[model samples]
Target: MSLTEIRSRIAKACDAAGRDPGEVTLIAVSKMQPDHRVRAVLEEGQRVFGENRVQEAAGKWPGFREDFGAVELHIIGPLQTNKARQAMELAQAIHSLDRPKLATTLARLADEIGTCPDLFIQVNTGEEPQKAGILPSEVDSFVAEVRGLGLPLKGLMCIPPVDETPSLHFALLAKFADRNGLAGLSMGMSGDFEEAIALGATHVRVGSAIFGTRP
Candidate 1:
């Protein structure tokens, strides 16, 4: 689909959800994608992008960073403790602040380096063992703990169980965010973004749908 069509779809979803499309931010996920494609999208007025791996993003970013000055880059995948420093340097937002050790490391790195990416607490809405986020029941305490450290703590993020309808998970997360008074909901992907928007997803990550099938 064209960029216009993609933007329209986001707008339609936001409207159907009784939301202003201006309130939702689309982060074009560019994992496994080439820099040229990202540049094209940047030209099309996309100002935010998401990448799953720091290394992959690092490889492509140097060439594009200067040109896409206002664009924001978010790290939306599992992050390792060892890579905390580099992750902080590269992303404007880090959406998977999963564990205390990693969070502490990030805090220290940010302090030492004088730059910290906006942080989001990732919730394993599905409670899947394979996932990286904190469980739903632990979010309040986790948020409290992270907040005490002065991290930006922008909001919550989640990946629903692959088998279930996404809205159920999205609703739970939306309510959770509302209860905590957080501003952003980094939920949804190419398949169920409309449902996420219906439940108040302020940030949606779209990869294949916008960039075409990954190689």
Candidate 2:
């Protein structure tokens, strides 16, 4: 889909939800995409992007930022504890904060560096054994722990089981964020973002729909 089409869809979704489209932030997922394609989006006036790997983003974005000047990068994949400092340096927001060790690492890094990116706790809402995220039942205590650490806790993120209904997980994530007094819901992707918007997703990470399939 073209950027125009994608923005139109976002607007429609916001309208359906009785919201202003400006309230939803669109994060174009740029992980695994080549520099040329990223530049194309940048030329089209997209300033916010999502990247899955710290190393990949570190390699590509420094140059992009030098050229583009005003882009925002978000870390949208699982983050390793050892990379906390690097991620804080590169990303404006992080959506995959799933473990206490990583939280502790970020806390220490924040104290040392005096910078902490916006953070979203990833919840394995489907309770899948292989996925990263605190389970739904663990959210309250985990949120408390992360908050006490003084990290900038923004909201919650989740990837629902592919076989199940996504709206179920989206609603659950919204509930978790609301219960925790978090204002951001970094749920939804290309496949189910309209539903996510209706359910109150403050941010949506979209990939192939805008940039086409990754090569």
Candidate 3:
């Protein structure tokens, strides 16, 4: 879909959910996308985006930021302990805060840097063993540990198993956030975002739909 068409659909989804369009955030996932395309989307007034690999983001982000100073970039992939400090330094938010060790590292780095961007607890709502996230049963203990680290906890994020209906996974994440007193749900992507909104997802990450197929 065209960028304009994407925004229109987002507005309609928010309306259908009885939510303020402003309350729901659209994160243009830019992994594997070139710097020029990122800048073009930013010029189109897209202010928030997400990147997957830390190395990929580190390599390409400078050019985009040089042009759009106010854009918020999120680190949305599995973060390594060695890269925690760099991620903290570069991203406006980190969406894959999935484990206690990573949280501890990020908390320490945030303290040293005097800045902690928004944090999301990634739950393996799908229980996919290969994925990077806390298991569903462990989210509460994980959040407790993160809270002790003094990092700001804003929400939950998850990518459900590819074979299942995403709404079930999105709803599970919403319930998880509610029980934990967290206020955000960064669920859904290109194929299932409207279902996500209906299920209370506050942040939906869209990539191919907005940026076209990535190289």
Please tell me which predicted candidate would have the highest lDDT against the true structure: 2
Cα displacement (angstroms), candidate 2, residue 33, comes to: 0.7
lDDT of 3: 0.89
TM-score of 1: 0.96
Quote the lDDT for 100 in model 1.
90
Query: Which scores greater on lDDT, model 2 or model 3?
Result: 2
Total backbone clashes of model 2?
A: 0
Q: Evaluate residue 145 in candidate 1 and report its C-alpha lDDT on the 0 to 100 scale.
A: 90
In candidate 3, which residue pairs clash? none
lDDT of each: 0.88, 0.95, 0.89
What value does the lDDT take at residue 47 in candidate 3? Answer: 85
Candidate 3 lowest-lDDT run of ten: 62-71
lDDT of 2 by residue, 1-215 (tens): 88889999999999989999988999999999988888999999999999999999999999999998978999999899888889999999999999999999999999999989999999999999999999989999999999999899999999999999999999999999899899999999999999999999999999999999999
**lDDT (C-alpha) at residue 78 in model 1:** 94
For candidate 1, write residues 1-215 as lDDT tens digits.
Answer: 66677789999998887889999999999999876777888898888889999998788776687776756889999999998888888889999999899888987887899878999999998899888899989999999999888888899999998899899999999888999889999999998888888888999999989989887
Predicted structure 3, TM vs. truth: 0.97
lDDT (Cα, 0-100) at 151 in candidate 1: 82
Better of 1 and 2 by lDDT: 2
Point out where model 1 deviates above 4 Å. none
